[model samples]
Target chain A: MKQFLNNLALSLVGLFIVGGLWALLSATVSPDLPSPWRTWQESKVYILSPWEKRGEMDQGIGLMTAYSLFRVAKGFFLAILIGTPLGFMLGSSNTFFKMFDPTIQLLRPISPLAWLPLGLVLFRQSEPAALFTIALCSMWPTVINTMTGVRAIPQDYLNVARVLRLSKWRQFTKVWLPATLPYMFTGYRLSLGIAWLVIVAAEMLTGTPGVGGFLWQEYNSLIYSHILLSILTIGIVGFALDRMMGFAETKLRAI
Target chain B: MSFIELKDVSKSYGPRNVLSGVNLTLDEGEFVSIVGASASGKTTLLKAAAGLIPYDKGSITMAGEAVTDFSTKASYIFQNYSLLPWLSAFENVNLAVEAAFPDWPKPMQKEQSEKYLQMVGLGAALLKKPSQLSGGMRQRVSIARAFATEPRVMFLDEPFGALDALTRATLQQELTTLCRSVGRPVTALMITNNVDEAILLSDRILALSRGPGATLSPAVSVNLPRPRGADLLMHDDQAIRVRNHLAEFLLAGSDRERPAQRPEAPAASKDVPVEASI
Candidate 1:
């Protein structure tokens, strides 16, 4: 608990620094810029009451934030579903590695943005398009990390597993998976963060009913406050998402 | 017929040779230690015997059957602790029994795993993962797992190399007594650089020269009395003499280094030779 608090405290320090810098810079550059205090007040007003503000769909900023988060989560989870196993196969088998490595490498270097149009074309659905883009954006790191982890298993462990005459599937689950989990989780954390990043940019292309579309809508209306507010929401939400992944990684690695 | 035989066992990787023209045999229930200065084909010889790598030349036979046939239930405990990091100590041991003896009943597996854990002083850590265990403790769990499998031929590759001296000695003593039990014997082939350990625990000691190394130097019978200990071997004169001869053979090729060339394997002789340096 003490260690947990220490880590939490450290993270709080980072937030404080970000707040301080933003406040300091905004005061000088744009006097009308959102001060940290004013932004917090505005966040409560906009985010807390997002649902109360009436519209045809009655979409409030809070509802919009929640909806965006839901989509981001769905997309992120989908990426993990697709990427993790690919990483394991590439990591475990030399033949599979040889077959997929070049293609993965080629695709990895191309921007996640480059995936948007291709995803839309392939998925044949705009929401899946955004999700697909995020998944592709994040998978490279997860796959590569997981593969490296699997490949890097110490020879000693392999010999022991072999000696024990563990069945093929048991060896993979008991020996290989556990051994490579830390790396896989590290990959998961990194990829999820990357996926969150791609979703916003991806939403722009697909115009999904989420934060990205919300940002675009506010920008079109020239509601710079809402625009700035959406940007802030993305930042805070992204930061929270990354932190959750980090926590998951630590807990998984310990296991 | 010799229970375990290596017929012209030779191994090479591409152009590089690790072991060439090597033949070795072990009697049933015998404990043989292969010792050499680091990089000797001692490990390769063991690897070939354990079926970890197929020899380029020759065949390995266990209990009159080709080693390929007896590949099942062969347990190898490596120098470095190789406990699956994900499983608790009990799970690691349990998994072994599960793979080998699926018909033995799940309760029986649990009982045997706990028994082995208790044997190795790991009874209290049944639920703890490998990362939570110390180096010595992890190796203990591995050793117990191997023993629990009732392996017909057990290969230990410097299983104590990473432990502190005190822990190494304790395990050595435990392993010695475990293997030497009269009713149900455990046949073991281990590789170690520690001469005292080889002399105390092994029935015979084979010292090899350095690598793409030379031929088997001398295979000596460790004539020491049973239930041996490290301090006892250190004081034994015959042990000292055998230790020196093996040491010279290891040092002899140190200066005359040759880029390793994997040798061709010789025909398997009936006897696993036991030369007494004394």
Candidate 2:
């Protein structure tokens, strides 16, 4: 209880510090800059009726956030489905790894935005293009981390498998899967973060009807307060997503 | 036919020979221990005998069948206790039982698992995972797992080496009792570095020369009475003599000083108790 109170106090102090800096900047610098007070006031309209729909392009903050989250979930899930099995194959077989490692290495460093044009060209649609970019961007971390996890399995465990003469299936299900779970989750967390990041950028570029697209529209209309509101919303949602994954990781480890 | 036999067994890792021209045989019910310096291929030899690792040369047979792969008839107890971290003590033993007797009903497997765990004094810790158990308790779980399988041949790789001295002695005593009480004869091949442990547990001790290309020294038979206890072993003159001889052999091997005289092969003289010559 004491520690919780202390943490709450520290969090409030941190918020106050940021608010104070913003207030100072708004007062001394250009009035065009959105202050924390202005951002909060602007946020109230969206917060009051977050699910309101004005138009296809002009939905409420909640709708935009939900759309963005949906895209991230789809892309991230796809990445996991493709990446995990590929990682296992690569990790288990040296020959397979040798064949594909260079290609993965080459493709991994390319930015999500760079993939946007390629995705657009391939799909000829903004929504699919955005998803493609998100998945492509998120995949590398999951694959690499999973492979590392599989490779990092302690030799003693493998020896136990051998001595017990555990069937190949049992070795995979009982030993390999559980041993690599923590590592795979680490990759999952990273991929989710990347997916979230890429979705916003891809949506912004493609002008898809999501939080990023809404932010861009607000920017075009010179609604700086709404822009600040959207930024705050994005930050909070990203934090929540990360915390959820962390909670799941803890639960899985207990099992 | 011997329960387990390794004839002119040799193993090499690429260009480096780990074990060379090794021959060993263990009859049913015999408890044999191999003692060697660190990195003397003791583990390699044990693994080869269990068919867990492939030997580059020679052959290993168990009960007249050529041992080419890991045999469910053989159970191995590792020094690290090698219990799946995700599994409880009961589950670990149950896994071994399930593997050894696939046709056994679930209830029978569970009963056998419980029996072995109880025998090893881990009945209360059946639900505890390896992470939750202490080093000693983990090893007990491992011992239970091995015995639950009712293996025709058992291989132990420094099984009690990781525990504290007190735990080691206690587990050693527990093991001796467990082995004697099994009713059916069990062939056991053990690799240990501790001389006293070898002397206390083994019917015969085979000392290995240092690697690479390590070979077995002549076997020194321990004629100490069965169901050996700590108290009995402490006061026994024969146990002390055997311990001293093993200590000398270990020390000499470590120092790279060959014994002045090499004894004839002791494997041929089945029940003959070879007195330790210092």
Candidate 3:
């Protein structure tokens, strides 16, 4: 409880200092720019109403925000599903490392947006395109983290498992998997952040019902306050997800 | 019964030979300690006996059966506090128990974990993580966890070497009592850099020579009274003699491995740790 209060106090102090400065700057610089007050009011109009559709319905931000979150969630799951096993392979097999390292390096530097067209070509749909793009963007961190985690486990731990004759499955589940989970989760957190960043661009491409799509629409309509509203929503949600992952990591590692 | 035999056992890593021509036999339930200077083959020999590393020549046999690779039921307590960093102290101990007895009732498993932690004087540390515990506390948890497995033989590779001297002595006392207790399925083989530790607790101390090539020098038998305590064990003449012999072996072995071109070595007597009575 004491820790909770301390953290709350720090957060409030930080929020007020930053928020007050932003409000002052916006109020002075341009009437077009929404002060914190105007932006908060715009957020209520654009965000809080969940039934607001993306392009077709009233131009409120709710549906698009949910869509963006869903795309990120799908991409994160897809990345975990594929990236984890690949990481295990890379960590354990010298051959896999040799084969994949060059390809991974070649591909990782190319933008997630670069894959957007290819994803559309492959999937023949907007949702799949968004997911594929997010997955592509997120995969490197997850795979690299897991592989390094697996590699970092001390030889003594393996020796103990071997001396006790841990079965291959038992070893994977008990030793290999748990040992790597922390690493994998760390990767997952990084990937989630990346996926969140990519989703807006992805939605813009797809014209999908998401904050990205709404932001694009608001720009087209020249409604800067609504655009600010969508961007704020994305930032807040992205920050929350990262915080969730960090909290989980703290709990897991402490145990 | 010559429960374990290592005949002409040799191990090499590519061009570097660690142990060569090690011939030793351990009988049923005999407690032994292997002592040596840093870089000696004490740890190497223990690893070989545990079948963690394959010997290039000869064979290591347990109960007349040649052991190849690591056996199915051994518990290894490593010196570097290799308690799975993600597990709590109780969970670390419980995991070992679960592996050994998968079918055990849940409450019973928890009870057994608590029992072992209590034995090591760490009953309050059950929920604490490895990072939250000190070096001495971590070593004790690892020891308790290994013992919780009720292993046929517990192979320790200097589990207390990293700890401070006082903590090492305290653990030694705990280990002696824990192993000597009736109806326990444990037989201990610990490797140590501390010569005093070997003399205090071992029934037999196998000194490993230092190496570019190293081997077990000779096995010095300790006839100290069982269930030894600090007060009674401090005055034992046999313990003193064994400690002196180990000190001599450790020094001579160190000198032999490196040529006389090195700085003159300290006297072996000064190297002996007389204050160690755990």
Best by DockQ, which number? 2
Give the Å shift of residue A191 in candidate 3: 1.5
TM-score of each: 0.85, 0.92, 0.83
Per residue, candidate 1 scores C-alpha lDDT tens digits across B1-278 of 77789877778878777777777788888898887666667777887787777778878888787776327746788787677777789998999888888899899989988988898889999999888888889899988888887777788898887888899889988887666552575678898877767887888988776667345765888788877766665688888877777666655655344323323433231111212121
Residue-level lDDT tens digits of model 2 in A195-249: 9888879988999888899888899989999888888889999999999999999
What digit string (tens of lDDT, one per residue) describes model 3 on residues A1-255?
999999999999999998888788888887777788777776685657666654462456656667778879999999989998999999999998999989988888778779999999998998988899999898889989999999987776786566545678877887898888889889988988998999989988788767888788777877777777887888899999999999998787654
Rank by lDDT, highest first: 2, 3, 1
Worst 10 residues of 2 chain B by lDDT: B269-278
TM-score of chain A of 3: 0.89
**Model 2: pairs clashing at backbone N, Cα or C within 3 Å:** none
Clashing residue pairs, backbone N/CA/C < 3 A, model 3:
A46-A61, A64-A210, A64-A211
Best by TM-score: 2
Off by more than 4 A, model 2: B257-278
Better of 1 and 3 by DockQ: 1
What local distance difference test score does each model get? Answer: 0.77, 0.86, 0.80
| Better model by lDDT: candidate 1 vs candidate 3 | 3
| TM-score-based ranking | 2, 1, 3
Clash number for each model? 10, 0, 3
